[model samples]
Target chain A: MSKLSVIDNKRCVGCQSCMFACSRRDGNAGLSNSCIGVKSASGIEGDLTVVVCRACADPPCAKVCPTNALIPKKGGGVRLQKTKCIGCKLCQQTCVIDAVFWNKEENKPVICIQCGYCVGYCPHQVIKLLK
Target chain B: MNAFNDTLSRVLYIDVKNKKFWVTERKDLFDKYIGGAGVAIKLLQEECPSGADPLSPENPIIFAVGPLVGAFPLASKTVAMFKSPHTGDLGESHAGGRSAVAIRLAGYGAIVIKNASDMPIYVAIHGNKVFFRDATTLWGMGSSLTAARVMREREIGTGYRSIMRIGKAGENMVSYASVTVETYRHFGRLGLGAVFGSKKLKGIIISGKQTLQVTNKKTYKDLYDRIYKEAVNSQVMKKYHDIGTPINILNLNNLEALPTRNLKQATFEYAEKISGENIAQNYLGKRVACAHCPTACIHLANLREQYSDSPYFYKTTFVGYDFELLYALGSMLGIEKPEDIFMLIEEVEKFCMDAMSSGVVLAWATEMFEKKLITENETDGLNPEWNNTKTYIAMLSKIVNPPNAFYKAMAKGVSHAAEIYGGKEFALAFNKNEMPGYHTGPAAHLGFLIGARHSHLCNAGYSLDQSLLLTQDVAPETIIDKLIDEEAFRQILSSIVVCFFARGIYNLDLISQLLATMNINYNTDDLKRIGKEIHAEKYRFKCREGFSFDKLEIPGRLFETPEPTQKINKEFMRAALNYAKEKIKCQ
Candidate 1:
C-alpha cells in the first residue's frame, strides 16, 4: 500500500499559501511551475477544487509515456525521470484529474512525488495522507 | 539578478497642476524597497510638503506594486499611500486585483501624482504610453459603479486590466471617500478617493501583457508546485474561500468582542443575523477573485428587493459584504436585518465611501440625536434613528452631495463633525481616523493609537492583549513593550511587500529562505534594523506634520465601556502613549 496526499475541500480557505510553499520547496519564488492546482468555479469560492496527483495503483500516465520517463514507483504510484522525458505531454492529456502539471521551463511533466511536505503547511487539515 | 526583465521599469511622475507626465528610472529605490507600500512610503516622504493639506495639490498620492507581482500567482495587490483627508496623517490602503499586475506589466514600478488638476480628467496607461484624458463628462457621476461601467466600455482593454475610479462623494471631497478598483474592490480607507478628487482626477485605467522570467527553471517548478498545493489545500486558505471574512463575525461575537452601537457596548444583540453562517446560507451569490488568485475569497451577493413604484415585485442588486462591513453598517448601527445592511453597503459602495468610516460616522450621528445635539430642524425633520436603513441610505446621499448643514458637517468625518457640534468626548476616532470594530481589549484601542497608519492589524495589539489575559494577568508596561516590539517587526513585513495575513508563513526564518532565493540575503536581525528604520521614517513624517502622541485625545466613552478584558484604565493608556512617544523619539 502507498500513501498519497488527499485534499478535503471543506477545510481550504483559498489563501494560496500552499501554492507559494510548493514553489518554495522547488526553490522558486513564484507559482509558474507548481504541480498542484487551485481554481474556483464561476468565481464562487465556497467550494474550492484542489487538484493533485491521485497516485493510482496502475497509473494511466505511466502507460502513456512514450519514452518510459514516467515509471511505476514502489508505493503504487509513478515517478517522472526528466532525463528520459521527451516532453511529449501525453501524460498530461491522459490524466483525468489534470494532476500532471507541465513545467514549460523544463519541457517536462511535474507529477507529485508524494513527499507530503505540503501536508504540514495546510493549517486547516484539508490535505491528508490516504493509504 | 535580473531574472525578469519586465520587473524593472520607469516610474511615472504626473503633475496634475502642470498637467505634465514624465518617466524616471530609479533602480536603486526598487532594489532597496521592493516596491509596494515600501516604495509608496518613500515617495510620499520625498514629495509631500510638511503641513500641507491632505486634499491640497501639495499632497502627493503614490501607487506601487511589488517585484513578485505579474510574475507570481496570488501576488495581485496594489498599495496606495497618501496624506489622508480623514486621518490627516499617513494614509495607506492595499487592494487585491489586476491593478498591481497591470501596473507592473505596463512597465512601471510606481506612479506618483503630485498637485491638482485644473479640471476633471482621467489618466489612461496602456503599455508604455500614458495619456491624461478629459473626464469632465464623468465628473460628479453620483455612482462609482456607473462610472466604472462607462470607463470599462470606453477603455481599450477588457479583463486583465484595472479601472480605479471615484464617485460623487469623492468629487464632493467627502473625507472618508474611497477609490473603487475593478468595480468592487476598493482602496477603502482614509479618503484616497477624496485625494484623487482633489487632484481633479476622476479615474486611472491601466492594462498590459508582459512575461516574466525565473532564476532557476527546475527548482522554480518544484517550489511553485509546493506553494500551489498548500494554497489550495491549506486550512487558512479554505476559511477565506468558504464563507470569506464574514466568518470572523461569529468568532468575534462568540468572544464578546463585536463592537455595537458606536462602542457603547461590546457584543451586538443581533449577532446571529450578521454571522458568516447566516450570510453564507441566505446570500453569498458569487465568490469572485483577483487575477492569478486561486483562493477566490471575494463574496459578491445579489439582494432581492421589491420596488414600491413599479409593477415588478423584485430586483436583484449585487453587493459585497464581509465581517467589517457587516459590523460597521449592520450591528454597530443597531441594524439587525441582513437585507437592510446589504442595502446600506450598496449605497456606501455606490458613493465610493469607506464602509467602515461611513458606518462609524452614521453611528455617531444617531448618538448625536440621542444626546440632543440636533433637533428636527438639523436633521431636516427626519430622525437619525438606529438601524433605519432607508434613513441611512438617504443620509448617505445627503452626505455625498451635502444638501444641508448637517450633511456638510457629517461629510468631514466623525472627528471634524464632532469638533463642530461639541461631541468630541465620544467621537470614536483616534488621530482623526475612525476606530475599527475591535473593542475587545485595551490592546485594540492602544494598537489603533500607537500603530503606524492607525490600523488594528499593524500590531494586532488587541489579539495580544487577549492572549496575555488568557495566559495570566500582566502589567500594562509589559503589554506595551510587547506591542511596540511586534509593531516594529510588522513594519519589516510590510516593507518587504508581504501580506499581513501570511505573518505566520513569512516568519523570520522563512523570510530569510525566501529572500535567499531572490539573492537578497538578510537575517532576522537585519529585518529588525530595516523595520525600525522604516518605522522611524514614517514617524518622522508624522511628527513633522505636527503630530504628537502625547497630545492624543482619548475618547471619554472608552472609559465607560467595559471591554472583553475589563474596563480600560485612563492612566494606563496615558502611560502607554508616553512610552510610545519616548520610543519613537529615542529612535
Candidate 2:
C-alpha cells in the first residue's frame, strides 16, 4: 500500500505550502482542485491537522459514491471518471478525515493522487511520501 | 490573461454616508500604478481632500491588494492607506492575514471607503453584495476578540472570510489605535483604527471563493513551482517558519540596538528571558501563516493562568509575541518575565492599540512619573512605574477610556502628550508617531524622522546602522542616499503589497514573472522606476498635507543613548534628514 504519512503533524506550521503545491500541479493557483486539507486543530494557536487520502485499503468514499466515478487504483486512492459522475456530495460526507475536497468552481470532488508533490514543499518535514 | 482573474482590474467605491457602493473598472490605474499602495496612493490623491482632519469623514480608508496576492507565495500583505491621526500625514500600514487573498478573491484591485456613517456599523462584503450591518451593540466592546466573534456569527462566510475590527481604543479614537485583522494580525500603525472610529466603521468582513485563471498557464505554473521550492527550501525563509520573528530579539540585543526603557538604554539586561528562542522553547503554542504565505512566521505565545476560584483549573490563552512586542512591552517597560510580557501583549491586543506606540507612551509616562512631572492625580490614582505589569494593565483601560485631561493627552500620543505635559526631551517619537523598538544609531533614527510613514517598516535603517558599525564608517550623505534608495525599492514591494519578510523572494526579477500571470508585463528596470515614482507620489500626498522634513524633530533621548554604532548626535541626524529633504525638494 502506498500513501502519504503524517509522521508528526504537531510540527505543522499551517503555512499551506503543500496545499498550494497540490493545486498548482494541475496548473491551478488555488485550493479549488486540491485534495489535501490543512486546518488549525482548533484555532491558529493549536497544532495543524493535515488531512489527506490515507490510501485506505477499503476506502469508505468509494463505497458511498452513487456512481462508479470513484474507481480504486491498484496501489490506493480513488481515481475519478468524470463522464459517468453525478455531482452528488455523498463522497465528501463518507470520508471521516474530510480529505475529499470539493472544487466549488466546478462541482467535483478532488481526491489525493499521492504523487507526493506536497511532501517536498513542507519545510518542516511533517509529511513524508512512503511507497 | 485568464478569464477568472480578469476582474482584478475593477475598483469598489463605498460611500458610507450615502450608504451606497459602486464598482468601476479602473484598468488604467492598475496598468500604470499596479495595485496595493501604488493604486491606493492615486485613489488617496483623487478622493482625500487636502488639509482634512484625520478623524473626519473626508479621510477615506483605502484597502488595496496586488495582482500576485492570491496567486503567489509570500505575497500576503494588504496595504491600508488613510490620513493618520498620529502623524497627520500619509498614514499607510500593511497587514498580513486573509486580507490580501480575501480582497483579490472578492474581485477588486482596490476598495475605497469614503464618508462617515451616522451610526456605528460594520460592512460585510461577499463577492459583489455589500451589507452595512448596524454594529452599535458591537461598538465599545471591551475586547476586539469579542467583537470579531459577534461579527463572525452575523457574517456568513468562514475560512475565506477576514474579520478586521477595532476595540474601545478605536471607539475612543486613540491616535495609535490599530485595526485588529483576524485574531492575530493587524493594520497596526499610523492610526487606521482611529480613522475607522471616526467613520463609525466598527469593522469590515470580506470573503470570496472565485478561482483565478493565469495568463501563461504553463509558464505561470513553472515559475510558481520554482518560487515555491525556493521559499520552502531557502535558509532565509526557513528561519521564519522555525522560531518566527521573536528571533530578532536576541540578534538585536546582541548588537546592542534593542531599545530598552524607552531609549534610555540600548540593550536590556534581561532580554534573554523574552527572546524568540526562549519564547519558542518555553511558551510557543503554535505558528501560523498569512493567507497564501508559505512562511509561518507568526508565533503565538501560550500563556496559561491558574483560576483562583476553581482549584486545579487553568485557562490557557494565545498571545502573539514578536520582536517588536518583546522590545516594547518587555525590555522597554522593564517587564522581564516572559509570561508577564505575553499578558501585557494580550491586554494590548484586546484594546486594539499599536503595541509599539503603547509601550513608548507608557515608558514616557513612567519617566515623567519618576521626574515628578505627572502625579498619581493625573494617573487617576494609579502609579506609573516601570516593570509593574499590574499598573500597565490598569493603565491600558484608562488609555481606552481616558477619564481626566492628562489621560486624554496621553491618548493623543507621545508627541502631543509631551507637547502639553512638558516632557519633550524624552518623548521618543518621530514626526508625532511614537518611535519603534530600534536604537541602532543615526540611520535608524533618521529613517524614522524622514520616512513617509515615520516608521521603521518604511526602511530598515537599523540594518544599515549595524553593517556600517561592523564594516566601515560611511558618510552621512551616503547613508541618506541608501535610506532613500531602500525606501524607494520598498515602495515597490509594498505596492505589490508583499510582506517585507519575503524581501529576498519577491526581488525585481521574480516580481516581473509573477506580474506576467496577471498579464501586467514589466521588467526589473521598469519595477525600479515605478517604485521610485510611487515613493514620490506618497511624498506628494505628505507634502500636500503640510508635512515638511524641516519640521521633523529627533528626540534628545536618542542622541544621549549610545548604541553599538556609537553615540548619535543631533547634527549628524539633522544633516541626514536635511539631505533627504533636499532630495525630495529636487524631485
lDDT of 1 by residue, B257-311 (tens): 8888887887887889888889899887766666556666778777999889887
lDDT of 1 by residue, A41-71 (tens): 2222135567778888899999999999999
Which DockQ value does candidate 2 get?
Answer: 0.46
TM-score of each: 0.82, 0.93
**Residue pairs in clash, model 2:** none
Tens digit of per-residue lDDT, candidate 2, span B1-587? 23444777799999998899999999888889888889988999888998998999999999898888777888888888988898888999889878888888777779999999999999999988999999999887778888887887777655566889999888889999999887889898788999999999999999875666787779988887787778777886877778877788888888888888877888889888888898899898877788777777888878998888998999899888788888888899988899999889999899899998899899999999999998999999998787999999999889888889888998989999899988899998888887777777778777887776454344668888887844677778888898888888888888877888889887898888888887789999999999888889999999999888878787778777777778477777777777888888722
CAPRI grade, predicted model 2: acceptable
Per-candidate interface DockQ score: 0.09, 0.46
Q: What TM-score does candidate 2 reach? A: 0.93
Cα-based lDDT for every prediction: 0.75, 0.83
Summing lDDT over every window of 10 consecutive residues in candidate 2 chain B, give the lowest-scoring window: B451-460
Model 1 RMSD in Å is: 7.3
